[model samples]
Target chain A: MILVTLLIGVLVLVLVIMAMGPLESLGWWSDKGAEKAAATIERLREEHARSDLRTSYSRYVVYLSGIGAIDGESRPPEEEPFVAAIRDGVPSACLVTDVFPYSVSNHGLTAQRPMSWLWRRIEQARFKNPEAMLAMLVNLRNAIQLFVSADRRYGPTYNIGTAQQVLESLLRHGYRLGSGVPVTLVGWSGGAQISLGAAWYLGLTKIPLELISIGGMMSDDYGLDRLQHVYHLRGTKDPFEKLGWVMFAGRWPIAVGSPWSRAVKENRITIYDIGPMQHNVKDHYFDPTAIAPDGRSYLQVTSDAVVALLNGTEVQVIPT
Target chain B: MGDFLGSLWRAILGVWGLDSSMAEWFRDYPHSLEISITIAMLAGVSTLLGNSVVLFLNRIRGWRFALSLVFNGVSMVALFVVQAVVIALIGFLFTGDRLTFFQAARAVMLATAPLLFGFLELAPYLGPGIARVLQVWSLLALWTVVTVVYAVGYWEALLITGIGWAVMQGLSWALARPLSALGNTIWRALSGSPTLLTAQDLLSGHQFMPVEFDFDVSAVEGGERS
Candidate 1:
């Protein structure tokens, strides 16, 4: 009995650890952050043709993926592929932060709001399409591990912790340009939530934060008012997060707070409802993925938007 | 086969109070306040009656037994209120605006199932290892309750447990001191030595019992906050 008990105890502990994922999502399971940073630095070393590589670029545009990973690698997934894409994307002049954190990496920060949003949608879809209902169930079960992610459950847990870790990593690598390193956030799917949470937190520290959310799930302001500007890009067939909007009337100001309508009106939050764009896309379809993904990979557009913001030029939010 | 074992293991753990079922049950359960009061009364009455029965079994007689009986009765009456107040304060501190007094009291009452091990006082040496292990297990159970109800982190749960215990201990010490002095005086009158006032004797004499519910602070699995 004692042996069996111990075995089960150990087994449960292991299962829990696996579910928690990567150092219990404390952001330092392995030295992945440092490893990624080194890889980015190494890539820059070869590409920039700089021998000493003593002083790298000052500014950075960090891409945080939505959900899942790219090429089955630890790196985050990129945007949809394209047709006859424009090559006028981000120039290699500015520094681009290349460490990508996957969505499953944040299984620990899965907040209830997102899951509840999905649940409400599932309930509404019950009367609609049976196929959509099945899809929703599959998505729910697949993402159930992340259902009650606990970032807000604590003062500054999980996603916020990841954001801080990312910065700490950048700072650790002598990447600090000045008192505050100018960084733009390119967040995809759930990654957008992390970016928004992080931007607000980093903003408090006087770090200049610009946000670009691609098919993000969270609809709340996430203190976006304090952010530089939030660019939200939603594709047409992105059926997942739209459920939150439709089910709860998208923005229930009474419960959480009022709609960020004024913020949207003032161009603080810009929504680009990009149709014919699914959640998944080819990588090299366009020059810029943000406004000008004529439509290529978001990597280029994200970089271009950041570069534009860095150069003090307004990147077009719509086709000119 | 492995899958079945895993599921069975989880079910067992659920019964042991590691899962959120208990917490969720309390969260969505109506009549929480009623349940909380009922549990509190149950714990209070059980402790008092259990101790009195122990004293009787030990052959405590006359004035000493009478004194112990009266003290136990009064303690029975006061335990629930004291526990509720202390647990409520700890819950407030741990959960911020998340938990209310009634919820905290309920969590505390549910959490007391582990302390029923105190009934082991009847037979002191019936698996001492089992006693210690149960206490630790109960602490985890308490953690689950706090997390589900309060939506708190494990560390926050630890703080709640620690603070709740410290406050309770402080209260017990305060309440016991006067009774201790009185017991010592009565023992002297009975020509008894201070050291000879055993736990059983004190109860039989209606004196104070400096019983403590404490464990090594370092034993809380992960690192505990100082």
Candidate 2:
């Protein structure tokens, strides 16, 4: 009975947390009022103007890191090489990696929040004791934002905020207006949902937008109608992506009227098998030591697939 | 204040039909003001936090909207009283018991305790499902009140509430056109809008249009800021 009560308490807490993101977006529990939020964007614009890299690039590649990320600037050691590979592969495109996908205001977990100390401790624990359970809190917090982005009722508000952040980041990285340069979003894991969420608002800017999901778990409800194309790079060994397919009704074959289904019917989504890579385990998608049967590292294979998609080249699919 | 909150918490548990002792506490101390406050909270929370309710609220402008809100809440309470009287009449017919209208009213008001959390109906994706669950929970609570509190047999109580519900539904169906017209008239008089925007219209209108952003390359130098 005690266990059952505890379980119920936890469930209620989770539901409360789930409701909070949308409520905050709706200005219910917002500490940062509309003026402040707008001011933040204005600050970004001013910073962009002051930046040395003001020259227009032909294309912009925005990297939205996975749920494990603490902030915009910090990248996990394991993931850094993969990002570096993408930079090397697509040197012509300006890569913007400082837009934190989990935050509506682009505020990081450690960024002056009420619970900043807790998050800081968790971030430290990830390095101090790599196997510490405290590190999972980062994933738990961000995973909730992913759901908020997928919710139809709340997605518009949350997505619009993230999209604004993405736009600001693009401008900061020298993306000239009306340059007609195609913007590619390289989203890893839960970042894929944020990318898709932001796609509709980004599309309004008249910039051609494409998505590259690297082992991303996404729901089908986010407006897929606006995206130019979706390249889902999945691994045969990864079961996490399949969880998305099973969990979301929109991803189901029966939901023919859903945006995901319509997009699939239109052949707007391309699925590529990027060899025997796991989702986020030791030999995950970005693990440089994880070698496939063809002798290329998982990082190299994933990066090459992303580069191919960015360059408008057909990516080779590895057979199961 | 602590005592009041404690009692309210117990009242919530009682309405879930979870604790018989809590149900007894509610029966012994049937505070009219407390029950009325609970009902008002239900209406106010639903108005403030419910997504669909917010859409309707958005249509209304100025201080009259608050007056209209209070009017609607009072009407809801009166409606519940009328429903209780109808249920009491039905119970009298089913069990030949002299269940007073006030007794039934109290029971009905207490049953609505579960719906105080109706604000949660604003939650995306799971909102509809949660609403249905709360409805079922309230039904069970009402049934428990009829049986355990009123001392009516379980089957007889079920028959009474069930028939009463059917009768109410029939009345609603019969009065749908007239009630809707009356509601619209009152809303128009209170709010400036003749009709509220449909959910689709509201949602579509709420889409993010980047009107502030400069799309032209030449206008980038003096881009519009919010």
Candidate 3:
């Protein structure tokens, strides 16, 4: 009798833990952040040649929060293939210091506002205090401006100015420098929102911007107009992608409908419901047959994506 | 007598890790009820210990560290007691026989004692809201313990306790930091009434800076003369 009770109790305890445990968005420290850093670094070493200008022909991948990685600290294993595809063909630089640094790598200092404006949304969501959220946003923006003004290399390098400033800056550089450069912007999770902001800004210039979003949370019309191709990937099993939790829990209208579902319905975007896989992309990250076991295979996937984007071909949507 | 023999056969299979299903065991060994019952008790005790250790580690540190040290020292002996009691209860209920209820009750108390201890340990760090939540949780837990004790005697129960300790710890770990952040933000917002920042603030990193209040005045003369 005692034994039976004990077994039942233990099983019940297990069930409770399983149900309530934090949704495995991504591994915070090791598997997500370190793994991603290693992958990016490896691609840089193998693909790009060290140029006199310290400039390499690499695309830029910007990860959005709540997509593949929540913070800069982690990238979903499923995202490894996308990054690897880019690394194989050209040297791609990852902008790790922008918004969403807390959950990214534990290495860099948190970027202030403007560089990390999306943090305001989280602050607003958690506290529902508009004033406080605004304060944080303004403070963050100022910090970014101060940081940006001090660093001249960043100004011309990434065109970090307003639309007119970007035009002037481009004219100064004769529009000849980045003419053939294929800069593919990859935004994961919440970064999908940030990518839209970037797209809106970049639309002012003639710089060819290729925007690819994996698990994007926001659907901005501005981004849609500017984007030539957008690859939105998600998994059906992913709780983060499901709108039900937010709808019931936050009691927000945004939760009532899925963003991807909407994007698909509007025909403004292409959605790829990948896999029988969960939100974590571990299954694809270490696939020896696809990417080399030692993580060499990660670049192959990135290269494939980059080549596909550059060719202006139809986006391939993979099931999450 | 037939019931006892059936339990014994089931217990032996459980101990040997041979027959996971009690129904299957009854089919195979219809005679060794006493032995089967003993096996069940032994297995229940071991499971309690194993689960308790996992729970203990979670409470102290977190899953990341627990994953590293599977055989750490902080073992929860109460887990085994709780497990034994639960198993016995299942057997008694299924067979329509009386169980060692007091023993099971005692076992459950021992298992859950650490959780109470954990609540006390983190009391200082808890804010008002968290404290309120924990207080209610602890009170309910205590009620459960007392009820269990009243229902059963200590010896026969084999007191398997300390279930859900890991779950509690995990919940605490996940909530603490984010909750703190949310609290601080709300507090600041409620207290400070500042203006929104313009694009200039974006450059400086603030929508609005707090107004400075200085009580110092140069030299106040008689009446209006300074």
Which candidate's lDDT is highest? 2
Two-way DockQ contest, 2 vs 3, winner:
2
- Residue-wise lDDT of candidate 1 within A1-320, one digit each (tens)? 99989997785454333333322332321224334433443443353353333445445566664444221122221233211111123443243343334332333222333454654455445336433434344333323223222123211333344555456545554554234556667666655665665554455445577777766765453446557787776655567557545432325544444335545555687776544344543322132344343753444444454345546677533342
Please identify model 3 stretches exceeding 4 Å from their true place.
Answer: A1-84, A90-107, A110-182, A244-268, A281-307, A312-320, B1-226
Ranking by TM-score: 2, 1, 3
Candidate 2 Cα errors over 4 Å, as ranges: A28-56, A127-131, A236-239, A316-318, B1-11, B17-79, B89-98, B116-128, B147-226
Q: For model 1, how does the per-residue alpha-carbon lDDT over B125-146 read when each residue is reduced to its tens digit?
A: 1223334555566566667777
Give the clashing residue pairs of candidate 2, or none. Answer: none
Per-candidate Cα lDDT values, in order, are: 0.47, 0.71, 0.36
lDDT of 3: 0.36
Sort the predicted structures by DockQ, highest score first: 2, 1, 3
Per-residue CA lDDT of candidate 2, range B137-217, in tens?
777777777775566677877887788777766766666566556655665675534543222211111111101211232
DockQ each candidate and list the results.
0.03, 0.19, 0.01
| Angstrom error at residue A316, model 2 | 4.1
Better of 1 and 2 by TM-score: 2
Model 1 chain A, TM-score vs. native:
0.54
TM-score of chain A of each: 0.54, 0.89, 0.42
- Candidate 2 lDDT, tens digit per residue, A1-320? 89988998887777666656465455521334334435544654565456454355668999999988889976556788888888998888889999999888888989988899998888788767755788788888888788778877667667878888898888766776555788999999999999999887676556788899999988885547778899999998888888889877889999989999999999999888878778876778888887777778888888888988887787755555
